[model samples]
Target: MALAADFRHRYVTPEASLYAGEPTRCEELAELLRHILQMVDRNTPFRHGAYREIYEALHGFLHAGIGGSAKDGLVWGVKDFWAVWESICLVHVVNQNPGDILTCDMEHLPVLLSAPERRRAWLKQRALLFARNGIRRRPDLVLAGGDDIKVVDFKYYAYMRQQRRTAEADEIDKIEKDYLSMEAYGLLLQNHFLRNADARANRLSLEFWLPGAKAARQPSRQQPPWDPPLSVVHLPAEDLLRGYVALYPHLRLMR
Candidate 1:
């Protein structure tokens, strides 16, 4: 029931170090609030068995050659959004299946950021300010289709079970938020790689997967079943922006 110790990658670059640290202030506070909310919602499954399955698998893959692996059991809690993101990316991005992967080297861009200090400054200026921000949480795969560049983040979470039967009254307020995040990323892609006047046009598209196991139990208030098919959500530029705006304030506090 204790929070997990930080498991950030050890091979942190100066940019990465600066990037991660910058979000701590406001994001930490927002997280404290979220934690309190979760405590009040005891019926909620903040951490579940599914999360542990994905985390351990991913930890194994990351440190397989380094002589380490994730511990057994749920290695992450429900609030640990990154764990879910990584899970989706591993299947869709790294594996490069149904989704095509873009292989451009993104690290080289910072070299042209005038001075190292300028790169840091640019990141701070553009960092997201909202809940579930992805400025530092870069996805695993970049997909290019026609004129669009799609970024994928994997996720897993239990929405309100009662909402399954009663629309709006019981279920979580599912909206077009995911699309908004993708839009923000699209804008970022355009600004960073395409719209810099000197850069090329890279119209980016972002997408994600929320894979859920089919429920073996009967549908009921206590043991609601997962949706029959996998719950896959895709967001375009406009939708992504909305999600960003909605979550931006809490997100900025992190930075």
Candidate 2:
């Protein structure tokens, strides 16, 4: 059978008319997707999340039936930007190390496992699970081996706010909370292993990573005896996307 002229005109050749309101790219892409849908209808299979996501966006915007576009009530700018930030950081870490990073109790966070060859392993031996939203339920990531473990929390703190000379009234509170939270994370991680008799390390190695410029000298670190030695690296945004490369050697990658 042949494709309809009206269908082709509206989606494939939609321009220099009232239909020009819709982007040419969306029109072209949606037309191509028509062919893909035809294949799917014939029992051909193509399992991909990207295709589905784009299809839904196009369908709603294009009204899913004939050729008319709707842009009202369609918005960007997510309120859960923190969730997106968390996922991106996880992607960077997994992509950087490939097969080195270990995740525990991440059934709730599939973004980390979205890639087929992410090279990350699900930690089953003494894995830790918590009660809360997906982001809060577990540490962002952990690197562990024979007797060394590093629990990394991708705390998207507003570092620039605190780095300024004139701190905001809440800056001190944020700093103190961030510091103490890392301490608590250390203890939680330490006990998490000890309880299951699966102590991967003699003690927990706590580290929280922040997004910022690489420091000329060490930014800061605490080494109190009672608490696990807490260290942090302010990874540059540029380096984070590059998967921790161009980052400081201290950004330990355990494989």
Candidate 3:
């Protein structure tokens, strides 16, 4: 069976957009479903929790059409879209280097606070940090190769529709929160991974894949205290592969 057909057979229900009469919406949903399945198939050692979360979230959105409470549904649908998008990008990079190891939701990292007591306090406060942020902050993908490690976090936001001021504000808030979380992750990587003499030094990269943005923004670099540089790449979702290459040019040599 074709990929789309196979996905529909496995996951799509009569309530899903695939069965909705709208041609354009149906086609778009079908393509997304297919892309997600392809990502799952290609990316071994995938996080079952993330996959399941996205799958269920999409299902809920499809079941609740525009006629219903679609506002919440759209929020969840886009959330899952980003999850699937990140999976697809990570899978492509992993395929390029067969020998490299990729891990998802990597939470444990060395804490290099000056005092041993401080290190323990920081470790114990991880839960508090997450609670304060209102989101679980962790690297979406971790690539380890030849003593070098690359930490990547993915952010997706649709371009702001001028009419929806509230939604735009929410997205802006999310973007800021993600940036702060990424900064923390960068610090963890530097103190935990790069502190070792044998480890290869590399910076953490945040790929903000905004498909709806009006224009592409230039990549910016930031250096946080006790952390290596953090590079932020703003690109459209269509250019994820290009963004990946821009962030990690070394991956091209592996191909």
Candidate 4:
């Protein structure tokens, strides 16, 4: 029995500064996300009921036995360890990666399992090139999925909307102006993760799942008119990237 039980350092070092810096650095991205979330929050307000139910159910389960589940109070902000681990596990099962899976929270994977370790290895192998300059915007999920690396943004919305200019209001071309609202997130992920990393396959996948709807639009029944398909306009990845780059310049003035 090699169990040493002598206590040494007691208090946990509070890292308030790191969290405090998150807001100012990611103001622009947060603002854009807030804009989109506002639409879901206000117009389709009733849809949030389902999200609340899920959050409550998960919270109850975690509090009942699982201890490490951090509670933030806000329905949307609740960080359940099980949810995160399940997501990682699902990806691993589908991808069939040999590397172990790991997370920041140690309690989430206390068994020292091979899968968790493989997951962590995959994450570390990514050529993560993040710019820590003017304003910092860290990607929500940064990890390597075997051969190719993935930078993902976990978006939780009640409903997705398509905004058009009203008859009396200004003529705003939201769809044309932006290809994909998520493109900015893609660019941000690239700037932070892929750029200056190892010589690996760099691909960014923006994972968004709404409370009432799937993250992206479903595939169409008929064939498209264009090569890549016009329905892709629905995805609008380029639009999102453009928006992010355009907003990047303004980040310096945000403070």
Instruction: Give the better candidate number (3 or 4) by lDDT.
Output: 3
Q: For residue 162, what is the lDDT in candidate 2? A: 26
Pairwise lDDT winner, candidates 1 and 4: 1
* Model 1 ranges off by over 4 Å: 1-85, 97-100, 103-137, 145-147, 158-181, 196-203, 212-255
Please give the TM-score that candidate 2 achieves against the real structure. 0.46
Give the winner by lDDT: 2
Q: Write the per-residue lDDT of candidate 1 for residues 40-158, one digit (tens) a residue.
A: 44555565787655555444433232222432211223334445334323323322343344432123121221344643543443343111343353433455555555555444433
Question: Mind giving the per-residue lDDT tens digits that candidate 4 earns over 206-228?
Answer: 44332221225532122322111
Model 2 ranges off by over 4 Å: 1-80, 104-137, 160-177, 192-200, 215-226, 242-255
* Residue pairs with backbone overlap in model 3: none
Give candidate 1's total backbone clashes: 28
List RMSD in Å for every model shown: 19.2, 13.3, 14.3, 20.0
Give the candidates in order of lDDT, highest first: 2, 3, 1, 4
Report the CA-based lDDT of candidate 4 relative to the real structure: 0.36
What's the distance in Å from true for residue 166, model 2?
Answer: 21
**TM-score per candidate:** 0.30, 0.46, 0.40, 0.31
Evaluation by TM-score, superior candidate among 2 and 3: 2
